[model samples]
Target: MQELEEILRAHAARYPAMEAADYVKLIYQNEFGGCPAAARDGEKERAVPPAGGPLCEPIGGGLCRVHLAALPQGAGPALDRLALATAREAAGSRERFLQKLELLRGLCAAGQLPLDSAALEAFLAQGGAAGPCPPHSGAYQAAYAPGYRVLRQSYADMLPAFLEAERVAARGGVLALDGRCASGKSTLAELIGRVYGCPVFHLDDYFLPPELRTPERFAQPGGNVHYERFEQEILRPFTGGGEVVFRAFDCHAMAMRPPVTVPTAPFAVAEGCYALHPSLRGYYAGAVFLTHTPEKQRQRLMARSPKMLERFEKEWIPLEERYFSACGVEQFCGVTVDTTDLF
Candidate 1:
């Protein structure tokens, strides 16, 4: 570990803009072989498939076939930052950063790192980021309805198709419920959980710890919650059928308590911002996208979280438009449930 840290610090001092791929190559050359090809052959020969199923064959040498099960949502800015930090550390001149990298590698090897939002943010902060991928979007937006009647009605009609798809879990399945904040994704996730008798996981639970939370993020022109951690922890586990422990964010305590082991029942529901990450498309059995006009979404946001309104308006709203709009509910989702129409 000490030797590895020295290598990282030396590399970072020499090449601050070193790509993650290049860093890995350096690590491999220094630790194992001079080339990744030799390392791949050695690892592959000893590679064991994950318990759930066979490993996926990666198209390129960079990504692990096992990682194919993991998906990344449209949280590019956060992810980019994470990658930058990791690259810096991998080639960094700091011993602490190298030590942190060693720890991360250990956690990953042990499969003990919870792939939740907090964990993802920590990973980014520590200097590890997933690949650079484009975000996915859905087509068709529904105008807001005046009352609850339409929303409820729309939900009733849409529930069956969504439920059936989840129950079936056929090839290349996904259920995307896209909506602006306060469009009731949590409520809907609960409803789906109750109806399907499956556990519901909130994406919010994956957010960075309170101490790590930044108001400045909201002030940034296109920043959203750092989602790299969330993708790594919660989303990946949920999609891959790996053992998932439910850990809720304690708003009052502003800390994450230990997770409770969530049962992997026949069907489960995951709800949060960017639940329909492009990489997760084929894995989900069903998708539900909630809709509302920007006005209605804003109203709901103000009603639910007044303090966050400025951030939402100044930061989140535009970020959503720029990053998440392309991956709208309709494009990635098979069933688009218009909240207004149902109520």
Candidate 2:
């Protein structure tokens, strides 16, 4: 609708260089009823319309609802092929809707079809009539190709940075790599450690013991695994020029594993999903944020692990958005590596 486009355009203007895909994700989350794909048996069909004002029911069901309105014109067949591919890739009755979305994006980019609501609806209807299906070769190949390139290029381009950081560390400077989940933080961390010959410590090791991992605090909106004991036992000791034993957290066991003494090595690499927490900012000499376009992030996640795509989109992404808004680290990052350039 004209109103939706106007709103998105206004919002995009506020954030320099924000892409159409990012706007699409934002609109899909805020203005639409967010849900996973509907069941193939039509058990989850429901009339969903655009939010904020009255709009026509472009499509019914979960996946179709958000995507139908977002796609451009004449992209129906490609969307259908993408849906079938997603259904086949995801086992059981549950569907990996985001995977299909990535596939549709590839089709749109490749000029295989024009994007539009009619095309999306028609594709869904056709898929429904065809019953259960198998994955499409084109869809799978196209969807994952770019992601593979991204991963490969990120690792490759990161080598020089890792070496530079290592050289700095050898001269007594600390390097900090920070980013949201699946933003290639860990891979970069590992690469940095290898290049610098430094010990790598993952913050996941410092989480509270499993028995204490109650849903009480973590279950709340904006809740995070913040354990004071972790700060005292792990973070303080290491950063204060003292040797501390490192114990990895066992999520399944809900306890810390046997403690392993990690000698205080110069140029230690402390990396995790939350490595750039404000509390630890002052200790790093240099920092880098691996920034990825939301579309690329979604595509990479779907390619690596289809099941995680749903959780990332529905739960993790909102939390991450909140975290970045609160921390405002984007403004302070010394270096930013745009993953798109590498891909």
Candidate 3:
């Protein structure tokens, strides 16, 4: 628990642009928001949010490891500062707030925060009306300047998928991430690849060539994807644990592109729609279905490709829904993640 606290503090210190008042509020939220399960009397139902920062890889059994050196840059320190500040709400109850007070006391003593011990305690005791910042705040952000935000906002939301990836990796099998078109399958896959160093294969890379897009094929559920080729080129070779070389279908060219090689890893990620088609589902050790509210999905689709929105609304979405219903994609998967808020 204390380790998690220290990690949060270190992360908070990285962003130099954050105001001192915001920093205190951010730290307050961090401490109270993710109080350890042990502190909650061993409750097993609720999940423990990622504590070692956003880009951590799940090791196994709900534990994660953050590799600091692998963290990326360019997202900007302002976002991390703001995210940390607003990531969680104030303590819901007095009891929890008291625990936060204790945690804050420890942090101030350990980190040498400029806050006064007595006045801070008195202010918090009077229902924490300290106006979002601590008094006598110090300029500590420069200690770890020019911080980066590596998917911190969505880290908690991505925990289940991370844990599932760990389980799949342990067994040395493929992990499938299937989802709605705009539901962030590709984003999740990229993040997973970053954290786990796994080979990520996209179903989009196997889109059916023009010749295979016959009316008869379109009539069948999950027929839009070139599963047969995917099986022969990628899944089959991947099963034997070796390099996977496959031709990616070029949608714009309406032809097969040159072959690309993906090196084998402890676990491989198969992502995008139709990834969990019945013919391909059996290969995965674990699968996660990503979904979002219709409104959010449309919003994302518009932002990504405004010209294709009508086609998605009228054609692609219905087809995907049909495949999902006919094949029970959500039910068959071990995890179903609602990524509506994460986006």
Best by TM-score: 3
lDDT by residue (1-343, candidate 3, tens digit) is 4644554455445433434343444444343432222111111222232334444533222233233333323222322322332223223454554465566677666755544566556656664534332322244323222122222334445756876776787678899999898898999898777656788998999888888889999989899999999989888889888888998988998877888988766689999899999998778899999999999999999999999999999999999999999999999999888988866
Model 2 agreement with the true structure over 1-343: per-residue lDDT tens digits: 3444344444434333333333333333222222125212121123222234222211212122222333334333333333333333323222333444444445445544334444444554555213332222233223321110001222235533544464447566456666666677777787666545677777666665555556785653324545455456656777777886767777778766898887776667666645666766677666777778888888888888998789989977776667666777666666677765444
Query: Candidate 1 vs candidate 2: which has greater TM-score?
Result: 2
lDDT of all the models against the reference? 0.46, 0.50, 0.65
Report how far off residue 93 is in candidate 1 (Å).
74
lDDT of 2 at 124: 49
Q: Looking at candidate 3, what is the lDDT of residue 263?
A: 79
Which whole-number lDDT from 0 to 100 does residue 260 have in model 1? 77
Better-scoring candidate (lDDT), 1 or 3: 3
TM-score for each model = 0.45, 0.49, 0.61
Model 2, which residues run further than 4 Å from truth?
Answer: 1-156, 163-173, 208-223, 227-230, 341-343
Backbone steric clashes in candidate 3, count: 1
Q: Pairs clashing in candidate 3?
A: 21-133
